[model samples]
Target: MEGKRVMAITGVHHAQITIPRGAEEQGRQYYCHLLGLPEIEKPESLKGRGGFWLQVGDRQVHVGTEDGVERSSTKAHLAYHVTDIMAWRQRLQEHGFQILDGVPIPGYERFETRDPFGNRLEFIQPLA
Candidate 1:
């Protein structure tokens, strides 16, 4: 116990997902306009770079710009806790986003989808 450092992670401050270079506007349209996430100003020091941030609940989601990576093939993703899953499904579908079913979990009902940039995302709701 003398040399061991105990690490306790309290909560997530933010999660970042990447989109291709120069696709920031499409990212904004899909995430902010279509998905209805509110945009937050990036710090002035970070503003010169491409991409933006979004506000989700009490957390910030950094949407960064990257190039040369295959976004669709990655299994990594962000899971957003949401209410009224059906409404969200309908809303995204109306905007031409496909709803993909995920594997069942014990106490959660969830589905997956891709942003226009092909970043994987999950919308999850707790079951009663």
Candidate 2:
């Protein structure tokens, strides 16, 4: 292995979350209007499937539509890093969304919430 090279891994390019059928508008309202993430266009080949793509900083969150699926917010979730934790928490509360407290993780403040379609999401801010 002296001359072997290991593959260099970079940051996440995108993460995909599923939404139930006919929930596109609700998804847009939450991910775009509330979260302030700009909606991006999907590839021409994939446009037939109903969904939305959103830009989160340098990364992307792809919300895809699935039919006939029961929605449940589980432990598996996507976590986004943010700057102001309290402000985000307030916003969620003001919007009538339930904020689930997260276990204390040193150097980070975090909370969990569910999207309109019951997709679990987490927001975190680094503590100095």
Instruction: Give the CA lDDT, 0 to 100, for residue 78 in model 2.
Output: 92
lDDT of 2 by residue, 1-128 (tens): 48887898777899999898778998899999999999999999998899989888889999999976555626789998998899999999999999999998998999999887888889999997
Which residue pairs in candidate 1 collide? none
Using all chains and alpha carbons, the TM-scores for the candidates as numbered come to 0.90, 0.89
Worst 10 residues of 1 by lDDT: 1-10
Model 2 error, position 3 (Å) = 9.2
lDDT of 1 by residue, 1-128 (tens): 58988899999899999999899999999889987899999999999898999999999999999999888999999998999999999998998889999999999999999988788999999998
| Number of the top-ranking candidate, with lDDT as the measure | 1
Model 1 regions more than 4 Å off:
1-7
Sequence-dependent TM-score of model 2: 0.89
Best-performing candidate as measured by TM-score: 1
